[model samples]
Target chain A: MSTGVKHFIAFAALAIILIALPKVFVSGSAHTMMSLMGIMIIFALSYNILLGQTGLLSFGHAVYYGLAGFCVAHAMNYIAREKIGVPLPFIPLIGAFAGLFFGALFGLISTRRAGTVFSMISLGIGELVASSALILRSFFGGEEGIPTNRTKFPPFFGYKFGPQIEVYYLIAFWCFVCIALMYALTRTPFGRMCNAVRDNPERAEFVGYSTQRVRFIAFVFSAIFAGVAGALATINFELMNSQSLGAGQSGLVLLMTYVGGVGHFIGPIIGGVIITFLQISLSDITKAWMLYFGLMFILVVMFSPGGVAGWLALHQPLLKGGRIFRLIPAYALALVPMAMLAAGLIMTIELAHRMLVDAQSDGSVMKLAGWTVDAAKAQPWMLAIGLLVCGALGLKLAWPKVREAFAAQSAEVAQ
Target chain B: MTPALSLQDVRKNFGPTEIIRGLTLDVMPRERHAIIGPNGAGKSTTFHLISGRIKPSSGSIRLNGAEITGMAPYEINRRGLSRSFQVTNIFPRLSVFENVRCGVLWSLGYRYSFWRFVDKLRDANEKAHAIVEEIGLGARRHAPAGILTYAEQRALEIGVTIAGGADVVMLDEPTAGMSKAETEQAVALIRKISEGRTLVMVEHDMSVVFGLADRISVLVYGQIIASDTPQAIRQNKAVREAYLGEEAH
Candidate 1:
């Protein structure tokens, strides 16, 4: 099929999924989760504009996200109080404008230089905003943060956004629009020059491009999108807090972008979904879920520096050559040892935590895999260690077969 | 005829050390001038000074009778001056076509244009394609510049240098790491691209210098010892002892 047709079909499929998702899930929590995911997808993509596309290593992107969120929240509150008759869904535009305003302000100073200096400036700004958010209680609302009622706004088309599902559709619409626009920006000459500046600033200058201008433009655009995401957050949660502007929030977006693979356009989307899923689902099961996230990020960096998208992209040639199915047996063979390794590692970690920290309160016995095991006992320790060693050995033994199979398939495809 | 580029009393200091000391030279319009020098003679430094990569301590540099001493590199580039680095400085990750297209973007008046898709710009694509074919990398146009062979990368470097359609082109050791056959090919390519354009080159290869240069300047210890035809430079006693002494063997 032609590429244009493929793109049309892909977009059509995406629209269908977006429209049908809340219907299929049909729960308030599901709507909430999907809305959060949509907001995160926008946030991640915006971060990618600087990190992935422009090669600017910003440590304080959440400044834009948080600042915009706060601005939108305040606007919403004012609108409701005055009965200004603005529709609920159009509030993100206010966030976009606020983001653009601050982006232009900060971007002018930060984009004067690229690399370490720019990163340092962004960090300083982020810290300044986050700290100021507390002292300026009227604007940031102190520890409580500013709250707004989305349903208070006059209904548009006779539909009040009181229901979570309504909010989901609103967020989803903005999400699709933002994604399409960001993707289009990447295809433009300015976007190409951003990559050039990122690769080699000297070469870019010789080619008649002002590296700082390219960076500043990209930074502003990124901030605008991030602000939109922040606005979505305000509408969804009805509150905008100082936590949104913190370094931790910035780091979370960075984690998502890196894990998704900044090299490809769709990488951040994958990262957003996976990281959001992990954040939501994993947090419910364990309080140490963040540790898992750090571990996943490290693994991605070491094994697949291009992130998940990059890892998947490696199979493109095989797929094109009609040889992707050839690696299935090898992948299946590797899965058993991989699962064993994960189980053994998790067991060791949980048991060790129980033995070291929780031992003072809860004596000896730890519940794992529905089995009660004595944490202080030598027998259980030996069992855990044996499983760990066995899993490691099994993986070591199985890896060569997977490698050999891959090599064979590659060689065949080459022929 | 007016000089295309003129440097008067050009001197560059890096902290305590002076690199280009009291260097003055001029090249007439459309002249292919070669600057030959020994190691550390500041040949590349001179290029940097002209291209605005580094500022000279005290000097007046002019291009087409316009002062450009303290201008930024892009500003100098905008005033019809383009250069390539001694090291292969093509964007390593971008495709060869994209690399050349980047060079042509500013000259084509597409400065910071985020509204137009670059692929749809027929003039830019055609110009970039012409450059790729001229550099003899037509088959490898789609390859990432990093993956090209050293000689091919050198060709790409030249392609990028001339892609802007600048009237004055400065190439720093464009054939630095090439084999003899590759150097011949590069010299031919350089000769083709530098037609009706002012070419300022810093080269070590005597054959390329004597073969392609309309006039040759011999630089030694940050000073031009001789500025004359290749024949006169070859005959000058100061040029012989200062630079061409080893090459004479």
Candidate 2:
């Protein structure tokens, strides 16, 4: 299918799901998921305005997101405390302009040089803003942070949004509007110049578009979207903190987008869902889930720099060339033992951490999957068997098919 | 005839070292003028100065008697003067058709189009299609320009320069790496495109120079050694000394 068609279908499906979410999922769960998706989608797409289309990687995008979020939080407080009567929908506009203002300020300096210099300046700015957030307590909420009540907003369609589900609809609506606008922006001449500047700045200059201007515009646009995401996040959480815009959360965005696929527009959406899901579900299952996630991210960076989207794109040639069914059986066959081994490893690591951290009081043990496992004990034999079987099966199933795919790719190249 | 392109006492210096030292030249209307020189003779720098890629340290350049020495490259292109680089400067990532479409966009006054889709810009698209046809790249229009053969890239470069519909067109080393057959074809294309427009090309191919140029100027050490008709340039003692040898003169 054409990429546009695929995107349309996916977007339509997502829209329908969002509209029906309150009916399906529990209100709390739906609200949380909607907020996460909304925030990440905006951030990811804004990041792509620089990274994907402009071919410029940014290390400090979180600064814009966090700053904008903080700004919106302050504005919301103003509205709540009877200091101002700033309307609810217009709050994001404040955030957007705040983002644009800071973006232009930073872009003027950062757009002068790209790559490492750009990243460093952005990093410096991120650290400065984050540290300042702590020092400036009165305007910012300081260590305690600021919280808001959404009931302050006037209701619409008989939905005052006192419930979480009502807020989810608001977030979903904003995400849809922002995504459509950003997507439409890409088809503009200004957006075309962004892509042109990425490929060849000299050519763009010769073609009469100032390369620096293009980069600056893209930077500002990305910043505005980041701000939009931040604003939505503030409304959803009803709380704003310094950590929301710090380096750690910013780094999480990089992990999400790249892990999902940076180039594909939908890649970040997939990434947001996966990471958010893991953050919720795995945090309950194991203490060392983040460690495992970190390892997976490192492996993904090293092995599939194109991200999951690139891997998906590879399936296109395979499917079109009639090698799909032939390759999948081996691929699935390789996965059976790998899953078992992963579960074993997780158990073993969690047990070891539990023993080392809190061994004195915990005397209970649980046995499952042929091993008598204590929560605070390590079974070396079980770990060793799991690793061996997993490794051997993985290598057995993966090597030949990978080789065949490469051979096919090279053959196509040769022709 | 009044000159179509003129450079007057144009001087360019990089900090302390002057690359172009008090050079003056002019191209007569509809004339095929060739500029030739040894390496580091400031030949390419002269083109850059005229194209506004670099500002002259001093002096004025006039296209059709309007001063344009210090204008930006795009502004110069808009003022009916276009130039191709010595090294092929093209959008490598764009397909051939899109590259040509970008070339046509500026001329069609669609500089910042947020409303018109590129496909819907019919006049510009048609012009680009026509340029692709003229450059004999109709078949390869869908291919990414970076993947083109060296000769094909040269052709695309010419197509791009001429696509803007400038009155005076300058091509630097237009046939640098072509075989004999390719050179002949390039010479023919150059002749075809230069009709009713002033052409100033810096060429290393003597056969192409003799076949196409109506006049020639030889430069040695940032100075014009000789400027004369092609036949006179072929026979001049100083031109031979700058090029072939004393014995040839």
Candidate 3:
């Protein structure tokens, strides 16, 4: 197929999936979670424009995400109070405005110095805005945040947005547009310049570009998309607050992008989906879920370092060459012991949590990955350590077998 | 011709030390000029001043009769002057074709544009591909530039330098670390690109310099001791004693 046709098919497939997902997973919780996933996907992708595309490490991207969200929240309130006939869907425009204004405003200072300096400036700005969010009650609504009613605005085409389904579609529409636009940007001349600045800023200047100008433009574009994502968040939760602009939120997007793989366009998409799922679902399964999240992040950074998508990218050429079956032996040798290692690690963490964190409040007895185990006893601890040792030993021995399987394919792997 | 590039009384100092002390030179339009000097004689520093990499402590540097003193590098480049570094400088992660294309983008009036796709710009793609083919890297158009062989990367650096259609080009030690064959190939490429434009280069390779330069300027201790044709410079006593040493004898 022609590339145009292929792109059409891909985007259409994405749209169909987004629409059909609600049909298959028919639950109120699923809709809530899916809506959240859409917002985060945009946020994380925008963060990549700075971190991945422009070689900028921003510790304060949530500044734009939260600032735009507040603008959107307050705009919603204004529209309702004035009965301005503006529908809820268009409120993101205000967020977009806020992003453009503030992105340019703050970008001048932040993009003046790249590398570690840019990161430090961004951190300072994030703190400044977040602190202001608490003290400026009239504007930020203090800690409770500015809560607005989505139904208060006029309906669009007879849909009141009162039901969760209508709100979900609204978010899905914005999500689709933001993603399409962001993807389009990566192919433009400006996008190439961003990459140029990232690869060699000094060379970029000699080629008739101001490195600062390229970085500043990239920062603004990133902020615009981030603003769109923030506006979507306001609609999803019906409340925008100080926590929206917190350091924790900024760190979450960073985790998503890094874990997704900064090298690929869809890396953050994979990051957004996986991280959002874990953020929501992991809490119910274990009290030490945060520990698991930290462990997974640390492992991704150290071993794979490419994030989940980058790991999958390694298998792409093999699949294309019809040699995927050759990997089965290696994969099995790796996965079997890796699973044992994960189980042992989790068991140990859970036992310690019961002793130090949960013993006084909850209990000494708890379920581990759906199995009944008493943290108070010695039997589980001994089993945990035994499995951990054996798992470590088996994985160590599996390395050569893993290397042997891919050794023949090394020619195709070097970029 | 008002000289394609004119540097009059340019000087640079860092703290207590003076690098380019009261330097002056003129490269005429379409004339190939080469600057030769010892290691710390401030040859690269002169290129830096002309290309706007650094401000002259005091001097008027002009390109095409227009004063470019204190202008930003991009502004100077926009006015049709370009340079290649002493070291191989390229966007390592970008494809070889993309690196060349980036050099041509601003000159082609697509400065900082985002609305249109780069692939769809037929004029730019054709120019970039032709230049890549000219540099003998057409086969590696899709390869990332970082992985190219050293000689190939040097050729690419030259391609990027000339791709902007600049009227005046400066190159610092373009053949600094090349084998005999590579140096000959680079000389031929440099000759082809400098046709119908002004070429200024700093070189340590004697054969390449005498072969390419219409006029050679010898710099010693941050000052030009000799500016003349190849034969005139070779026979000058001051030039031989200061830089040429026994090579000229």
Q: Which candidate number has the best lDDT?
A: 1
- List TM-scores for all candidates, in order: 0.97, 0.87, 0.97
Candidate 1 CAPRI level: high
What is the C-alpha lDDT profile of model 1 across B104-186, one tens digit per residue?
99999999999888888999999999999999999999999999999999999989999999999999998898889999999
Per-residue lDDT of model 3, residues A1-415, tens digit only: 9988988998999899888888988899988888889889899999999988999999899999999999998888888999999888888888888899999999999999889999999999999988988998998899799898889988799988888888888888888888889889999999999999999998999999999999999999999989988998998899999898989899899999999999888899899989999999998777777788788889999998888888889888888777778778887988888888877898899899898998898889887768888899999999999889988999999978888888766555443
Candidate 3 fnat reads 0.94
Candidate 1 displacement at residue A325 in angstroms: 1.6
In the range A1-415, model 2's lDDT, one tens digit per residue, is: 9867977997898789778876777657756776677778778878888887787777789888888888888787778787465556667787798789989998898887667777787788788888998999986688877777766865555666667676677778888878877877777666666777787776666666666777888899999999988888888888888888788887888888888787666677677777777777778766677787897799789978878887787677756766566666666755665666666666656566666665666553644346566664345546745776776677677767756755665466445
Query: Which portions of model 3 miss their true places by more than 4 Å?
Result: A410-415, B246-249
Which residue pairs overlap in candidate 1's backbone?
none
Instruction: List each candidate's DockQ score.
Output: 0.90, 0.46, 0.92
Clash pairs, model 3 backbone: none
Q: What are the per-residue Cα lDDT tens digits for candidate 1 across A1-415?
A: 9866887887888888899999899978788899999999999999999998999999999999999999999999899999998998899999999889999999999999988999999999999999999999999999999988898988899889988999999999999999988988988999999999988889999989999899999999999999999999999999999999999999999999999999999999999988998899989876567778888889899988999999889888888889999999988988887887788777777788787778899887978878889998888777777778888898898899988987888888888
User: For candidate 1 chain B, which ten residues in a row score worst on lDDT?
Assistant: B239-248
Task: List, in order, the clash count of every candidate structure.
Answer: 0, 0, 0
